[model samples]
Structures are given as C-alpha cells and as structure tokens.
Target: MKKITFLLVVFLALFSCQKTDSEETNPLLNAVLYMQQSAEYKALTLQIYNNAAIHLERALADKNWTAATEQNGDYQNLPPAVILDVDETVLDNSAYEAQLINSGRSYTSESFAAWCKEARAGIVPGALKFCTAARKKGVTIFYVTNRGNAQKEDTRKNLRRLGFPLEKEIETILPRTDSSDKGKRRAEIAKRFRILLLIGDNAGDCFSGFTHASQVKRDSLVRVYQSHWGSKWIILPNPSYGDWESALFDYNYKLPQSEKLKIKRSRLVE
Candidate 1:
C-alpha cells in the first residue's frame, strides 16, 4: 500500500509539472482572450455602449449632422440611419473566439460557419438599449458586416432572437460578398439615408483606408480623424481580434505560428 501511494504521488507531481511547463511554453495569450475573459472588458463595453446611447440621442436631433464621410449632395434630405458592424459590436461572438482558444485551433471559415449556424451569439451590453432607443426614434439600423452572405440567415435569426429590430424584408443586413472592405456598402447606404453615426469595433468599419493599413498608417489615419471618433464614430473595445492583429504581421495569414509570434513580440515597445 505504501509503494502504491508513493507511485500515485509521483505521478501527480510529474503531471502538475508538465501542465505548468505547457502553459509557460504556450504563446497564445492573445488580447482577445484577455478581453473575453476579463470582467473589466464587460464593464468597458457597457460604458462605451451607454455613452453611445447618449450620443445617439444627440445625433438624431442634429439634422445637419452626418456620420458617413461618403455622404454627398442632399444627404440631409434622407431619413436618418445608423451604420453598425455586427460581430463584436452589436453581437457578442466571444464564445466562438473562446472555442478557438480552448480547442487549441485557429479560426477557420468552416468552424465559423458552424458556430454561426448555432445562432447562439449574445447581444453586447447596452446594445439592446441603444438600438431600441434608435428604433423608437424612427432611426434606421443597418448592419454592415464582413460575414459572408452564406451566414446571413443565421446572423439574422440570431439578431432577431436577441430582440433586435429587424426589417421584415431583411434589407438591412448587408454581408460581405466580393470584398471585405465596407466602404462601398457604406456609400450605397449613404445614397438613401443620412447616416447619423457609425458604430463598430474595427477602424476599417468606419474608413476603407484602414482596411489593410500598416500599424504606422493606421495611427496616422486615427490622428487625421481624431475629431470624428467620439462624435460620429463610436468604437467598441475588441482586443480579442481585429485588423490590429493582422497589421502586426503585415496581414500575412499564411505565416507560420512561430514566425507570427516572433513578429508580434518584436513589435512590443517594452
């Protein structure tokens, strides 16, 4: 019995040591993971959306105001609308992100489609209140997302299930088709509605130039539009994933994991 007890202790100690080593060697401590798992992230999201609600009220009353820089002649004559990005903005997809981390896998279209088919995404904090307020004020809500059209049905179902205002014709949900850049789609929407505000987690959602910009270019663009940020564009916190990550490695999706990790580490200021 003593011999068996001694062996069991040895096994447990070895297993614990291996587990700690694995964690220390793993380089998947992404910002998205931290953002998704932290209570502070939830609080910040709620704060941003609550602030958006306040700004939405102000934007609606300002007839001369327009959020879309693409808006051209006679834009003020059109109905008021707000352009919003779907993922990580209005809808929370941290579960899908978490699944990738927990499973020790990267994001794949097949997995993403499977996750969307479940239609289980939850509404972001204060999103319902902000959208509901906009709806009540007769403002149109247009969701422009990079999610392909193949996921449109599931996306719509998920949004509707969460009590979001959805048009019966489903014209409001615009998914990516030929390109991921949303500037063209925003232009199309600008032709009809006077976009009051643009809300998203990515800088690309607001400006096409930021779509594939380098880290330095992105910083420059942000400086250029510094004034428009809080007034016309409400950006949510999405440290989990976005163009920012892609910019780190120069948007090279094919790079090996180790190479990407090296580049990411090299860019650190500290």
Candidate 2:
C-alpha cells in the first residue's frame, strides 16, 4: 500500500513537472511568437504602419529625395513610393523553420518551396497595415524579395492571403532570378520607382552588394549610406539569417559546414 502511494505521488510530481516544462517551452518561438499568443502584439502592425507613415510624411514635408533632402524642395509632397523586401519583411516564414526544427527536419529548397506554397505565413509585424496605409496615401508600395522567381505566383498568393491588396498589375513584385544580386534588383527597381523609402530584414535586400562584399567594403558601403540609415531605410529586425552571416565567411556558400564554423569562430571577438 505504501509503495502504491509513493508511486502515485511520483506520477503526480512527474505530471506537474511535465506540465510546467511544456508551459516554459514553445515549439514556435521567434519575433512573432508574441503576436501568435497575444492580441496586443498582433496589433503592433498598426503602430509600425503609423511610424512608417509619419516618416514618409515628414520626408515629403521636408522635400527630401533621400528621406528629407537638403533645403526642402518644392517637390516635398511629390508622389511617393516605398520599396519593401518580401521574405521576413512582409511575411513571417520563420514558423516554417520552427516547424522543421521541432520536427527534427533539415531545410531543403523543395520542402521550403512546398511550405511557401501554403500561403499561410502571417504578416510581419506592422508590414501589412503600413503598406495598406501607404497605399491609401497614394504611395506605391513595391515588394522586392530575393525569393526565386519560380515562387512568384505563390508569393503573390501569400501576400494576398494576408490582405495586402497587391498591385499585381503595377509591377511591384520583384522576386529573385538566376541573375539577381542585391544591387541588380535595386537598380531594376530604381528604373521604375523614385523609391522614397526602402524596408527589409536582410542587409542584402536593403543594400546592394552588401552581402557579397569584403568586410572593409561592407563598412565603407554602410558609411556611404549612413545618412539614410533610419530615415529612408527602416530596417526590420531579424536574427535568424541575412547577408551579414554570409559576408562573415566571405560569401562562399560552397564552403563546408566545419570551415564556415571555423571562419565564424576566428572572427568572434570573444
């Protein structure tokens, strides 16, 4: 009888511990974790929109082609447009990676492409409403992502699912092709857009040649664009991956995993 009672207590303690453990850990954890769990975080989209809207308004009022130009020109309130990076900028696909991590699966283009086709990715905080409001203000919002061009139709569908009201005919979609570098696409975007404001998660998406450049070149390039850092270039937060990570290893995607880790370790200050 005592043994049975002891076992029962042990089982209860184990159950309590398991419940607490589950409460402490989540399979889907990322910047959007709060949004998925809380309504308050979900509404942050509006705040993001408002902040960006204010930036654009201020830029226009100040007449800045480069996010508040010098001397405030007559074109202060001229028609405005924004360039947005797609992956991680407007869509939160980290959940798919989370799903893979939780399931002990590796990332593959085939699997990722399959996941991309789901079109279930939630919007990045504030991206949807910001773009929506910008659209209302007659600002053309264009998405410029490094996603392969094959995913174009699916990407558009995903954006539409999130209520983006895409300018499908306005030529805003800019997915990556075999020939696209970060700058190549930006140059393409430049041809059609004044591109008053630019937004994205990755440095490559935001700065052309930034990812594939030497470290010294990276710093120099950033300095050249330093003036526009926060004003015209509103970078979204992302820790998972970016061109920065690639540049750390000299942009050699063909390097073995062990060599990459060695390179990262050598560069570590600590």
What's the TM-score of every candidate structure? 0.91, 0.74
Candidate 2 per-residue lDDT over residues 1-270, each given as its tens digit: 999999999999999999767544432344335545566654554565566777887765554474322213354444566888887778988788677646655456888889888878878777877788778877887787777877888998999878885774677788877655656666655555456777876656666656577887877988888866667877766555667667788778788756876887798796
lDDT of all the models against the reference?
0.87, 0.70
Look at candidate 2 and tell me the lDDT of residue 74. Answer: 50
The worst-scoring run of ten residues by lDDT in candidate 2 lies at 67-76
Taking all chains together, the TM-score of candidate 2 against the true structure is: 0.74
Candidate 2 positional error at 76, Å: 8.7
Q: Estimate candidate 1's alpha-carbon lDDT, on a 0 to 1 scale.
A: 0.87
Top TM-score model: 1
Q: Model 2: which residue pairs collide?
A: 45-126, 64-69
